[model samples]
Target chain A: MKEIRVFSPATVANVNCGFDVLGFALDGLGDEMVIRKVPEKGIKITKITGAELPYKAKENVVGVAGLAMVEALNLDFGFEIEIHKNIRLGSGVGSSAASAAGIVYGINQFLETPLSNLELTAFGMKGEAVASGNEHADNVAPCLYGGFTLITGYEPLRIVSLPVPEELYVTIIHPHITIKTKEAREILPEQVSLKNAIKQTGNLAGLIAGLYEADYGLIASSTQDVLVEPYRKNLIPDFDFYKQTALKNGGLAFGISGSGPSMFTLSKGLQNAGAVEFALKKALKEKNMKSESYVSPVSKHGNRILEQK
Target chain B: MKEIRVFSPATVANVNCGFDVLGFALDGLGDEMVIRKVPEKGIKITKITGAELPYKAKENVVGVAGLAMVEALNLDFGFEIEIHKNIRLGSGVGSSAASAAGIVYGINQFLETPLSNLELTAFGMKGEAVASGNEHADNVAPCLYGGFTLITGYEPLRIVSLPVPEELYVTIIHPHITIKTKEAREILPEQVSLKNAIKQTGNLAGLIAGLYEADYGLIASSTQDVLVEPYRKNLIPDFDFYKQTALKNGGLAFGISGSGPSMFTLSKGLQNAGAVEFALKKALKEKNMKSESYVSPVSKHGNRILEQK
Candidate 1:
């Protein structure tokens, strides 16, 4: 039996202005996967959890991602996979992405597939599609490449890695509630105004230019979304307060992380990230809502092998 | 009377997936403004060419943008303004923008006020504010900054100019009819699906990353829009055929210029751009529509001073 272990960091998909195409990994929290090649050619699964997740191997999100890996390899390999989840699921921490990334990483290592990071990102998204019934690369790409990633144009699946300045710090707040991707998606618009569309595209362009120039001021300013956030923000608590605090406290940008119940901000340092957190918690408490927040640096590392805990 | 002549370049806003914050200038076409130091301390304006526009000086778009220039300098100089309309009005080209840009650029130089490109961008957008009653800066930033610019946020606006890629070429198809920006905006939805928003942001992120890395393929792949195009595309004749032809003929990216009645494609060379034009014309003929096309490079020059014609 061949036993392989892998670790994938929790990802914040839809980083501010990126909506669906941008994501970055957080170094501290994530999931660990243990895969064993057995005597059969199918997937057998188990899950150790933080949030309630499906466990039947074939129906599991990880199983779907593993299936893509197996199909790509064109080899018959029966696998037993154990996923230990650490990140809070449905709190916009990319719970399903951890398993998806871990499974892909483990399988690639096991099969010795010569897949590039971009390829790994594309492959990692099969699990996202399985979990959300949509192919979203934000969680997968960041979990695969670490740092920040831009998933451009979905048909050809363009993926690009961007520079993460050393001064950038991140803070996340999870309110301990499971807002499923489907629910989050349903609350969104069927269409957007042309005016809003232009604004969104322009902001996106500014954010990109900001990253290239390392102009934090532009990044912070360009993070506004006129299209989706205005509609979906209704689902999150203390949205306005957190946004204000993040900028007021020295964060360059802040927005709803992925879909809901969770939020994040990027600052020049941890000290300012504290202001971001304090602002979020204060607003949450003021609204009579309970939440836990974390402040950290941008994760420079992605998926890897971890010692079993 | 002190006559200060200023030329502004036509702009293509919403470069593919840039949505609201991204734009670029086109060479050889724009409006020209000549502001003279008059005896009075207020503004007076006159239009010599290009369709009927706001006739009054202070109530005019160009006059509004000029106000930003003078206000910044704290100067009360009265000026007589003459507009030389170069680009077509309501052809999906930035018509009012040229006037605004030209006037602002001329007045800024005339007063010797030193504002950074970003500051000037916000200032020039006072024209859009007058025209649309919305202080959006997509066109104004590109008009002021030249080349491609990203507008990341609104309010205390943030803008940045992206480094121009050496191999980039622009192919623009301007149809005969005009699509009013306001009417075009009315056809769009007040909301957007989270799914489409994610895709839009993703394509945009990819587009930004592509711009930074100068990866043409990724740039092409990331220029898609799922949110606005589906609904507004119906307003433009032969939209899909033109898009396909552009792609088949060597174009890397394609999208509506701003509202409608005009479209643009990004290519790597003149040869490919020509091929795209040929295909575009053929496709337009098949759909019973006619458009004048131009193949050129992304302009690094925004508004400028040109010899009087």
Candidate 2:
């Protein structure tokens, strides 16, 4: 195929107790990219649409990702890439990750030589680094591999896809406010007490087991976070109210999505997910804050070919 | 039944990456207890054997656990308890936990009034407190719940049993040396760098995912510890040698069992377990240290009734 179109899903990183280590993909909110082979022997971002993102080949996520992919494979190819971004920037929903993952995925398909998911993640992380000033893969790995992923190690780029329960729904509320990833990261402490560290470990373990066993109750209880959320929650307005209201309305668990002005809740069924979204929106409305809510099933697949020719 | 005999399996606490949070039970090593109804209105420890443990009712683990059980249930009947401990004290295996859990299980069975595993764990912690001066439940939770367990919380006694893969084997080597639990705990730092903490959390998430998915390779890679093992490994003789030797001989993972003079290695099959055990023994002999090695399948059931009359 000389041309391909791919879609990459939005991802929720940290996953409460699994701060810096766990994330999962969502089905509805994502970004799309179309790539076509050109006569030139170099990658280029010819056009961008649907969002106000950097268009430069080095500054843009899609361009950076495409460059990384080409350089890693030492391939001589020309590509004109167009991005149609749908995921919101600074909403803690991995918008840049979607762009990076989608472009690389589409380019790989167009070239008819697919890189491994881990290699794609490494390239995608270059795009994330362009956006966030560091190379981290918690969001990008899930965006590339689909389902729930654990960033087991960063030095070696180890990513493991964890089991996702069949009946899981993800309800996300994106407030009309933005928090820069760098500032949110700056608010965290450099050290944590050994006591909290151990508790966090237990919660992460519980969350993983819950996913495997499809035990909703265990998942709910294990979603409690004692590490990053305690410090970063203050950055998001009405964080506590939304979380409590969502839980009261039937959320199985609730937490900040990434470094958020956005929040995510998990529910076991579609009905409860709607209720949770309703509760979160109502809570936001009461506080005179504008918000948008999306309820989608946890995405079992990540980046995928939308069209091939 | 007027009398009952029960067995509580030994446990490996911390489980490398999950220090203070995760544990699993073993099949061949444990403690046995016999409890019988008496006319007296209180619990009593009438016999103690097979280990150098306290005989006094309040100070002994079996007696402490039995008293906690009787008090929690508000039982009006008296009980005579006998302990036949096979797990070695100060050996890093959950020796005291086995005693505590065995007595509680026997008493609960004899009275025909079974308590929930969490409640049993609470009583078991009381026994552990008598031994270690703290109410930690990492060892006790797995001893009571069986298989793999995550101690999600301590305040209200939250314990979750994790799945154990069928082909997994636990190989333990107990060196003829003593490392007091108190001293082992004292060696840990009160605080850890946030960077190390995050890495540890990733390892734990990886390990839990490994347990659920039955992915032995993930489990092996995730078993690396950056917390307690670093400080506590110094207390064991030739810990590095044994760990390296076992890994070289096909052990999937290796670490200190609890607080260690004892060490544990995980292997995917019985043949690997045997090879790991032989290698560990050879390493110890080369260092002029004597040790006993046991290879057993991961126990599917925790405390169980041995006999009733």
Pick the DockQ winner.
Answer: 2
* Residue A134 C-alpha lDDT in model 1: 80
The deviation in Å at residue B93 for candidate 2 is 0.9
Q: Tens digit of lDDT per residue, candidate 1, span B13-100?
A: 8665675667888877777777787667666775566667777766788878777667666676667788878777777667777777
lDDT per residue as tens, model 2, B42-152: 677778788777767887888888888787778878788888888888888899889888877777675565678888888888988888888889888888889988888
RMSD of 2: 2.1
Following a full C-alpha superposition, what root-mean-square deviation does model 1 have from the true structure?
Answer: 4.6
- Top model by TM-score, which number? 2
Candidate 2 regions with alpha-carbon error over 4 angstroms: A74-77, A111-113
Task: Tell me the interface RMSD of every candidate, in Å.
Answer: 3.1, 1.0
Clashing pairs in 2: none
The deviation in Å at residue A181 for candidate 1 is 4.7
